[model samples]
Target: MSINDIIAEKRKNVEEIETKIAQLNRKLSFSTLSEEKKKIMEEITKLEKQKRESEYELQKLQNERLNELAEQLRKRREQEKQEERLSTVLPPVEEFTLRVCFKCTEKTNCEAFLTKNRQKMLPCILSELLNH
Candidate 1:
């Protein structure tokens, strides 16, 4: 359950305890129900303690959620700063060398062109015929 829901439930329980306590007080005033009054008072004490515990738990959950959000924000900011640094440090795309294949009309970067040319240096027979 959400923190607000937990808090509302606990408050409702506390209100119920208070209402019972009031009823018990009225009964005690009217008749000699000492034993019943004692039991009700003990129950009231337990309920009050539970209410305090609930309030403490609600506050703890709220603080934990806030801390989690703050941590995520910190991580996001660090990631953005790292990205900015990378963008500034890296070379521009236009500065890199490019090559085009005469036979296949394929375009590629210098590294890829070197690898492809190293694999097969000769132009295709069909390309030579088309050129002639």
Candidate 2:
């Protein structure tokens, strides 16, 4: 049938074999010599092999999911950088040189100059702290 159906069938078989092995181990603890006892020991070994294979398959599926998540994070970062460039918004930079002129007694003439538009440089609220 489908891929999922195949995996489901394999998993079910593994569980059934494991249960059979557990039952056989319980029977093998006593001194016995029948042909059935030898057959149960062989079956237990086979079920142990199947259990290892199923565990490996589960680990492979988990690894694939981790790789998919890493790829999605890379794609998202690229998209955000492209959008920022198209909008023409400059990245923030330090304005360590912007200070008020020394023509006033108080610090009510502070300004924050932005490279985006010189005309948009408004008075800074830092003036309030200075007056207080």
Candidate 3:
């Protein structure tokens, strides 16, 4: 079962145990026999322990869910940061095409020319050529 399902089940168990304990306490108050009162008290104590264990499991599952969400958020933020860096480094394809391909003598074979002469400083070279 999923963690959420398990957590819900645990919460239900705790609620049921609490209800049973409340009923047993009511019984204990009404009963006059010492043995019956003692038995009811014992059952209440056992149910309370079960309730505590169920609550602990529910808390653990919630913490795990929170951790998983935090990890996903961190990865998404890292990917966005990487994309931002790349955006700053590389001109958009449309901008490159407008500034270089539209004006090049090799317009008919610009794709081939660009592939063969690809360089880190291609924008700078294009700017110098355009200036002259």
Query: Which numbered prediction scores highest in TM-score against the true structure?
Result: 3
lDDT of each: 0.61, 0.59, 0.78
Residues 1-132 of candidate 3 have per-residue lDDT tens digits of 988888888888889998899899889999999999989988988888888888998899999989999999999999999999988876665575556654565664676346644463366447746686
lDDT by residue (7-93, candidate 1, tens digit) is 567667667766776776676667667787687677767767776776677677667768878999999999999988977874342
- For every candidate structure, what is the RMSD over all alpha carbons to the true structure, in angstroms? 10.7, 11.1, 4.5
Candidate 2 regions exceeding 4 Å error are: 1-17, 85-132
Top candidate on lDDT is 3
Which 10 consecutive positions of candidate 3 have the poorest summed lDDT?
112-121
State the lDDT of candidate 2 residue by residue for 48-128, as single tens digits: 887888767755655665677789999999999888885555322233124422322333343333232333332332452
> Could you tell me every candidate's TM-score relative to the true structure?
0.48, 0.47, 0.74
Query: Candidate 1 has what TM-score?
Result: 0.48
> Against the correct fold, how does model 3 do in TM-score?
0.74
- Look at candidate 1 and give me any clashing residue pairs: none
